[model samples]
Target: MSLLRQLWIMVITITLLAFAGSFAVSMLTARNYLEQQLYVQSADNAAALALSMSQQSKDDATAQLMVTALFDSGHFELVRYTDVAGRVVVERANHAMPEGVPVWFMRLFPIHVGAGQAEVSDGWHQAGRVTVLAHSRYAYLSLWAGAFRLLIWILAAGLLAGIVMQLLFRWVRRPIVQMVDQAEAISERRFITITEPRVIELRQVVRAMNTMVARVKTMFAEQAARIEALRSEANRDPLTQLANRNFFMGRLAQALENEEFAPSGCLLLLRIRDLAGINRRLGRERADQFLQFVAGKLASLSADRHDWLLARLNGADFGLLAPGLSADEAPAFARELLENLAELRRIEITDESDLGTFGIAAYRHGDALSTVLTRADQALAQAEETSNAVVLLSDSDTQATLVAHDWHTLLTGALTGEDFLVASFPVLDRNDRLLHRELMLRLCQPDGRLLTAGAFMPHASRLGLMPVLDLETVRLGLVELGRVSYPLAINLSSTSIADSGFVDRLVSLLRQHRDQAGRLWFEVNEFGFRDELRALAAFGERVRPYGCKIGIEHFGRHFGSIPQLYDLQLDYLKIDGSFIQGIDEHPGNQQLIKAIVGIAEGNDMLTIAEGVHDDGEWLVLAELGVQGWTGPAATGRLQG
Candidate 1:
């Protein structure tokens, strides 16, 4: 139990104990005092009445009259006068019973006080003995009233003290709660510190935590830097800093294979001719510098395109692939790139013929990488015969590419209308137990073809409609969750996570469905998380009370150092496909997956893999302790 709760319980217990003890003692004492007063009054009254009877005639009439008068005064329960012969001359009795006190209470603490008695006498001689008893109804009534009043006071005081202690304990433990939060953050991988509190003991603890956090951050930073360096070295070319041949080929293979990018795209090659001639004239050092310059220019070209990849394919060849680009556009793209390079090297290269030529080919569905490369190479061989010739192979023809205005109009229409919705992909555990439905937003095109968020969200993001897309996604997920009993995972963009208004509205929506909040999970993409960590963490904190689980997808891709996934109390980690691909054949990736699994284990998080293909990779991942799996394999399992 929490210390605050324990303390409150202790306070209440002590209060009740003290109240019970004081109440019992007061009740017993009051009963004794009242009994004594009643007895004294009864004894004294009997003596006075006997004396009055002795002073007067001791006849039966007078005795009966006096007894009647005393009984009528209502203090005595029984009074009697007897003659010397033991014959009763006068008598009085009362049968009134006290009310307003429960029988159980009276039975629990019974008070019995006998009536008082005294001898009666005339001036020097005894007239007749007089006897009297005091009425106990009034005394019982008085005691019951006093006890009720005492109970009320005690209860009121107990309640007031309880309220005060609740507030007091919460205030006293406020700094401790913050320290606990900081510790939890550390456990989650976020090293953090807090201000020292006023209490001397708590201040010492907080200061110690702050020092520990500083050391942990330093330690993790050094370790993360080493891992990041190794990862970068494994994928990047040393000289140009572009993706190495293996990495480039892997991406190229996926581009040709992935369902999202296979439909329409272009692969272009820029070949530098007479490399030996230029290297001999410029020397190896200048030639290397020239190659680096060219690599930089090619890298700069990718900045404008939404989905693009550039790589150093080989010593003399460089490759650029533009996904979602149609056929005819490849020519202008090829021309613009060559023109930029020529303008850049215009002063350096005196002869325009010294510049390289371009060979481009547009790819459609079911096109093989080898076939496309052959087509581009044939075009390059033809271009090599001419000066600064840019060749578009026979395969490269026109199919229309939608302009930006068209996308804006289509996406805007879908949002304002009822066409915007989401489709869920299943996430299953190792035992094929369904975990959740991963909701991906979809836009129903006018042609009745459903377009995935991957198809339109890029343009939406650039146009600052990410927040709108996120809001619609959340709405769709909530409505979907209500229809199903299983949990659902919703993706929130960085823009929506950072937008205060969006967060406020989203939180309110979650609250309105508070009962089902636990069944709804939220996740942001890896890049989105990197875009705004603090905002995401704060947003998670706000919704945490509603029982929503938060985590990142495409995890461990750019993990140079663990981004405070621990701090977020992340529910699960989905390993990116880059590491998951061909894992059975890649020992290095297996080790990387093991390392990621270790991190998740330490943080008490669930680990899953994305884009899983082979059964061997799945088995390897399962042996690596991945609790859940997603992607095509898991999807197929769900469907089966």
Candidate 2:
């Protein structure tokens, strides 16, 4: 039962117990008092009767009648007159007894008491002694009636107390219910703050809930800020204040996919008329400023309906992807942007106002970035020769360009068909022994061409297909493992690492091949680990059994994260190639390598240097406390 129900039940139980106890005490007291009063009344009546009989004549029937009448009307049990020698007696009796109370109540607490007695005699000389027995019928009646009345009073009092208690409980529980409703709302992800309650205890609960809500709001705000930072870093160009190449390419691809009018729209490439000369005359910083000014003007001229996107492709090169715009409309937008740039340049460069020269080239759908850029370069050259502020290619390039292939189709085909393959890379030990061979997955076409991760991973990720590929790769690795006894390592995708089912499968695989588990290694990228370290660590602990080993690949550059290394039971750390490429000369690189070694050593983990192609870097690393090394220097197989 709930707490409130239990408490109310306890209250009722205690109240009933108290009522029973009071009833018992009252019955005992009332019975005893009645017995005492009856005894005194009998004694007084007997004495008075004896004195009156002595004063009258011996055969006085009047006195006898008076006493008999009183005894009969007073509900007496028995009245009697005895002679001096006690040989004969005069007796008076009442009718048979009547039950006044329930038999169960009477049996449960029987009211048994001795009857009151009295002696009747003539005064001064013993005439006849009158002995009387007080009746129990009147006492039983009185006791029964009193008990019934007390029960009714007790019932009324108990009812009133329960009603008052319920009212008080309702008042007290109001704020508690409000707090509960607020908590329920929060559980449903609908945040609500409750007003402070009058009850001190309930007010504390509300305070805690309010604090929790505040914390959640702060956490949400921080998460939003983090997402915004990531977005800005992904899209914004720090230097030109325009979108970067990645953002522009993403939008361009999206535009191509929108088949209605976006895929058939114009793409434009804009360039400074004479960027090198401008840099030579005004210095590099000032030239960059000029480029920013041109970008600003282009941004202002583009209409929102056209969905124009501007990006800095490189130094002095800008791209405009305008979805739903024709090649003719592109030149108009370019002309307006150039005019704004010209006006701004005239105001800034008062001495050589003609330096505001620029070029624009536009192409309708199917024109590659390279082709458009070439046309824009040609236009810029022509503008330089003619000494004009702006120029566009008048002739449309009617020749067919290479069609941008749908990468999603290729990914889907590769994932569904038998196009994906796994390749092995050796991760050697310190003595150039094959400690483990890492399996790297590659996608190959039916045309005998191999595709690297760069060719399909981004598309696979965009299509939410990494987990499938990772699972397939793992199955293939297990298949290949059945063929060999060498130590094998399989790389896990970020999505796979976060999946609980994948973790379970990995553990199950190891458990199935318990003897081979010591030879099996699981690898994850440093980037993936950083994203979900806690989850990965928990996964690591879950799979630590069955003798499997876990290691991180591309593990360097995030030196501040070394503290977490102590918590994770990683078997090895693969230092990134950047630090190992030229470790002897760079002092910073040397210190970093040593620090990583120290961190791993302190945590009882082995450190491996990747890309150690030469003996010198290898020797340096060995001296710096690296226990394992894997690079081109190590042979594919362990030499016995």
Q: Write the per-residue lDDT of candidate 2 for residues 1-640, one digit (tens) a residue.
A: 9656765776677678877888899998998898877777666666666666666666647546756876877667767776667744456777455476676765655544344434444554556776556676677778889888888878777777777777778888888888888777665444567788788887898899999977866654554344344434544677776777655654554344322123345556665656788778888787777777777777777734424678887776677776545555555666666666668666784224554344666554446546665766777666566543456663564222222256667766777787888877676766776677777677787688876553455456667777777777777777777888887887777678898887787777767766666666787877678777877778777877766778887674232223255446688888766467556655555666676676566456778887565678788888888877765555433432
Position 472, candidate 2: lDDT: 71
Query: Which residue pairs collide in model 1, if any?
Result: 188-566, 188-567
Clashes of each: 2, 3
Tens digits of per-residue lDDT, candidate 1, 111-184, equal 66566565556567666678888887888788788888887887788778878888877776889889989877
Number of the top TM-score candidate = 1
Model 2, global lDDT: 0.66
Q: How does model 2 score by TM-score?
A: 0.51
lDDT of each: 0.77, 0.66
RMSD of each: 9.4, 12.4
Off by over 4 Å in 1: 1-181, 187-189, 196-204, 253-263, 304-306, 343-353, 364-382, 393-399, 556-564, 623-625
- Please report how far candidate 1 places residue 196 from its true position, in Å: 4.8
Please report the candidate that would top lDDT against the real structure.
Answer: 1
